[model samples]
Target: MKKLLIILLVLTGTTAIKAQTRTADESAIEKTWARFGNSWRNQNFSDMKDYMTPDCHWINVVGMHWRNLKEVQFAHQAFITAFLKDAKAVDKSSNLRFLTNDVAIMYRVTHIGAFYPPDGIDHGTNKQGDKDNIATIVFVRQNGKWLIASGHNSDVVAQAAASDPVLHMNK
Candidate 1:
């Protein structure tokens, strides 16, 4: 009986250690997301660039795609230069899944509001739409830091319906 109790205690202790380690990893990944949001709100495109890998890719709600880091950087720089003079964003992490110790997928919601210069290019159309959307970001730990590997952004309602069975009850 004493031997069985010791074995059980060891198993529980191992589980507790794993849980703590997993929580630490999640917190670190969350910080990466927070940094991405801060970049948008603070207009720090350099930080944004740093958060992504060289071959990182992204597809937006409008079907616009950025295929690589350079392309993403160029687009972000253009927006910052020509618009987004008064841009604000709040990013919240909604869900996370770890595929491996080095890879994670995160779902988040971002609310963005922007005011473009009156004479700026594409001023007639609010390019960002100043609304909330859902984003899925794939992060891979490279050389000890988390960086975005790929991402997709789309309408919140659509994503929620697809992800939540409770929301899809009728259809």
Candidate 2:
């Protein structure tokens, strides 16, 4: 019994150590997201590039796919200049999961202040005067830095009747 207890303690200690290490990685990823949010609000895609991989790909909420860092930067710059110049971005929440020591995925919800749409109408915001989007991002640890490898953003919209859990739960 004493030998078994010692082995269990060692296993528990190893698990604790791994959890601590994962927590640190989670914190680092959160910091990176905060920096990216700041860059977005400031309309500084150049600064945002620092957090992304060179071949990073992004799909915007509207389904536009940017194939590389340069394309992403250029697309954001043009859109911000045209419509979101005065917009504000706030990170609502982030959920991170590690696939491996060097690969992670983050699901982030962001609130964007009211802005003019591409149609020249002030219709970007929702009823709360903020547009909320959920983004799924893939990150890779490269050279001790967490950089975005790819991501896709989608607008959070109201649930339709088909999506109502109460209506489908009985069925």
TM-score of each: 0.78, 0.82
**Per-residue lDDT of candidate 2, residues 1-171 (tens digit):** 999999999999999999998888898888887777776777777886789888999999879999989998898878777667777777788788899999999999888776777733566462232678889999898999988899898878755537867976765
Residue 159's lDDT within candidate 1 is 44
Tens-place lDDT digits, model 1, residues 13-114? 999999998898888888887777666666667766668899999886668799999887777667655566566667644899999989999988877664
**Model 1: CA > 4 A from native:** 114-128, 157-171
- How many backbone clashes does every candidate have? 0, 0
Query: Whole-model lDDT, candidate 1?
Result: 0.78
Question: Can you give the lDDT of residue 20 in candidate 1?
Answer: 98
Residue 55 miss distance in model 2 (angstroms): 1.0
